[model samples]
Target: MSTQHDAEIDALLGRYFDGLYHSDSSVLRTVFHTDLSYVNGTDGTYETMGLEDYMARIDARTPPASRNDPREEVVERIALKGDRIGIVEARMTMLGRNYQDLLTLINTDEGWRVLTKVFSFVERKD
Candidate 1:
């Protein structure tokens, strides 16, 4: 039973990683809630925004096709408490910089969706 639950969490984590790697806003819409909020490391501040704002950022981001080759690291951890809440951390590498994000997820009637994300620059060892 535990293994099955782990597998489910793993799939959720994968979807989150794939979404960012491909810059697919629709995938993001699936993973994140309508009231999602996040802190932008580049700005060093927290901002509360709707799903549309989040999607806009994804759209504004320089697509992987435009970059040399963006690489997304594996999800380090994904944990769920019962069936209502979860968390995941993933590493991302692009443009000679390393970034990390810790995401908080909430299970809604529809399914698991990210409620918030806290992102930061992990390292820049180029």
Candidate 2:
């Protein structure tokens, strides 16, 4: 049986994926902490951004609603520390690339919120 913590984490991850696909900053906001940071590894370099900047980038883009893209997320691992922190590793396919992301989350009074995301993406050769 899944615990409340498990359910909460699941919901949080779901919202994250949905937010990315739909480009809905509001939905993303609910799951991300105010101090959010994302470190992205691409090509042979790394780029990082804060929550506001990332959300703004999303807001400026056209929503992917018309893309009908496949969102296949595989949760590779989940590690819970004490009761307040969790680290989740997941892989998904998007924009013709396969991405692996590590999300750090914190359990707050309101709920679990993602604090940081470190990810790497590689183009699908197939």
In TM-score terms, which candidate is top?
2
| Clash list (residue pairs), candidate 1 | none
TM-score of each: 0.79, 0.91
| Cα misplacement distance, residue 10 of candidate 2 (Å) | 0.6
Runs in model 1 deviating more than 4 A are 1-4, 41-48, 65-68
Task: Please report, in order, the local distance difference test score of every candidate based on alpha carbons.
Answer: 0.75, 0.88
lDDT of 1 by residue, 1-126 (tens): 374457656676677777777788887788888888877665555455667887998888876645657575767877777778878887778646677889998878877788888787745665
Clashing pairs in 2: none
Q: Find the candidate with the highest lDDT and give its number.
A: 2
Q: Which stretches of candidate 2 lie over 4 Å from their true place?
A: none
